[model samples]
Target: MRGCSRRAGRAARKRRQKCESSIQSVSLGHQLQYVRLRKFLHQRGFTSSLLQPALFTDTGRGLQTLKTIKPCQLIISLPESCLLTTATVLSSYLGQYIKSWKCRLSPLLALCVFLVCERHRGEASDWFPYIDALPTTYTCPAYFADGVLAVLPAGVRRRASEQRRAVRELHSSSRDFFGSLQPVLSQPVEEVFTYEALRWAWCSVNTRSVFMSHPSNNFLSGQDHYALAPFLDLLNHRPDVQVKASFNDATRCYEIRSVSGTVRYQQAFINYGSHDNQRLLLEYGFVAPGNPHSVVYVDADLLCDVLRGDRSLDQKRKFLKENNFVHNLTVSSDGPSWRLMTALRLLSMPQTLYRQWKAVLLGQAVCEEREEWSVHTAVTLCQRLLQDTNAALEKISDLLRQCDPAVREQLDVVQSLRQEERCILGRCLEALRGTVRQPDEALPCQPDDNDDDDAVS
Candidate 1:
């Protein structure tokens, strides 16, 4: 993990260079936007101990404390008036038209519509400063090029594809809704709300929105759903920092505070829940450096070695679903969850014993060969993990030699992810080396007998 100062310095240089490019004006305008935004907040009784949006390499734009802030101290307070929430939508002219359609537009989708309408409104849009401040480009894997996407771990690829489909669906739904209203409305479809424009709005909301609980509201329950916070959305994510963000009735503003003390000039980050890199890049367009929660999923095909044949594979998958054990096998900072262990055990066991094993799994009875089956499962799992870890190491070596900055940057992020995954796999292999050597037990898979520390790699 790079120190926060070092990471922040690197981010400053990248942003400075990016700012020197055509976005220079946008960065300059952002400074004034900060002034106006702070004034806007002040008028609404929103005040804090002087944290401002600053550049960082990992998070791009983020809030940095200008003064020492103790734990639980107020960071920033965004009034509900400043929040673009469900009520804001239901009350907007566009929101009213969508509501009259009698079709369900989720709060999130509705916010997407609101974002486009506001952006299209231009100077007529009351929130132009905030809208203009949003990045025209995103670094999220969802926006990764197809070639770049090809090299990502399977879980990230799957998520990026799903996000693409979801945004497409939302944009399609919204476009059709707006098109229906165009004849009765004054503006043309392309002028006000095109699919492309709506997609940009969807991206803004998707990447930056924060959770808001409007508990006492009548239109929507306080379900901890998301809402777009004007300036507050600029806060980036850091796994090491803890922040408490919620609506304070007494303050009547959405308040975010550092739960861990932050000193002058140190960037203050918020936890976007306990997320891994696959999730952060999928949603927020950036990855935290040295993210301990980085995880890699084992391809279910590994199970095919033991399960064998398409019929047996089908049965194994079906069995997992039926018993609610269907989870992608993962190796993370904490190593594999018990769900993966149970899955490996179930996959290696003979099909004939399933009838009895099902009962044993449900606490109905114990299998006589339970201990032996566990050893076999462990050996099989370790061997497979070793193979995967070695393959990833080879790929990591290949990524290191890429010359392009884009490819280089991608390499940096993927390298962090794969390295952590490799580490977990190595430790797992070590623990099972003894299990693999056990006598008189039928080995699930004969692993390479190499005992070198780097054998897994």
Candidate 2:
């Protein structure tokens, strides 16, 4: 048995090497830009021999391992001088203007401005190789077309709208700041800092920047904490990978170490936090098909609508709001989230038992009858959500047929989001159904001598 196990392991290793060779063979066509980026990084003292840029079939472009990485191994250590931070912008030729300008600029805005300016410089800019490698456009909700945005779940759609508005407002408010940079530019400020240019730069920073804390700087408005880590940002997000990333004070480099090692030739990933599909789609422009953290949110207003006939609606709403349970009510595969179930329990209580509301909130066992009502309410809400999800999916399907390829891609992302929500709702509906008990099986609540709360009219 030991001999057979050893032979099996050797066979598996051989299979991995063969598969990796095929992956590398196909990736050669896509390495031109990355080759330039590598040379640029090496010139500036950035080194990572363990991983190389590769076009992955599953994750598009990401860092691939050349050898099997062991747990707790340092994956990449990027030198501080190579990072594009607000400090980098401050020290550049634009520094004097930024410092002398009467108006203060935000750290994020400064990064965006520096990115646009550097991008405009083309091959003339020292950072051109890095800039050239970035995606020309991003799929972040800010870039989603109106028709596509309309199909997103209501909660995500609202947040996307807010993001778009913020970007537009930022562009509008920076006209004076852009004008101030005319001294450093050969072209007019209007031409160099066009809205489209700024939008691209804004999305680049939003999607790719790493959080690195820097001490207070008077020239910048907010905290100087964001840094755009080149090459390192190529490590795509995986909801399951465990990694430790931070700026090493002694090494003077930003480093990421793998807690869960990756096998040879596979895409090496880093955790971008435990983000749900909605958040990942909104901010990163992609969806993890089976993200463990995915959930379907129950909108507060929708919950109220479902319990519209309840007499204690006003009181329950006030209580839920006061207790800070008014938001983040959700449904997962495991059934209703605690907050959602708790809210439903309070809403399920009859007016006669209004005084027992505190007990219910405190997690005291309510009468089985009340519990049944709460389960029934949850079933009805989940049914409504499922219906809405189905309807939205139908609309998306129709839109997919009529839209062009570009629009179809965006619609596809929204479709994935709705479909994931539908699955969660189905699971919740199933779980809620199983918990529901018939009225005849319900037991009476024990009486409390101090109160008559158990007596139902």
- List clash counts for every candidate, in order: 1, 0
Model 2: per-residue lDDT, tens digit, 271-361?
8888888988988888876677889988887887877766567877898888787899898988988878887777766666777777777
Model 2 residue-pair collision total = 0
Q: Which candidate leads in lDDT?
A: 2
TM-score each candidate: 0.76, 0.89
Residue 268's lDDT in candidate 1: 67
What's the lDDT for candidate 1?
0.63
Q: What lDDT score is found at residue 416 in candidate 1? A: 58
Candidate 2: where are CA atoms >4 Å away?
A: 1-25, 28-30, 437-457
Global lDDT of each candidate: 0.63, 0.81
Clash pairs (backbone) in predicted model 2: none
Tens-digit lDDT string for candidate 1 (1-457): 1212112467865864454343211132247767776776676666655677776554456666678889888788888888877777778776557656756666667777777777767757777767777776555554555655665666577777787777767666566677765654446876777656766777787788887765444343225377788778877676756889888889678888778777666566677877766676677665555566666566655555644533455776788778877655665544455566666555544555556546534534223343345555655655676666567657757756864666565556556555655666676666555544467655433111321222100
Q: After superposition, how far is residue 97 of candidate 2 from its true place, in Å?
A: 1.9
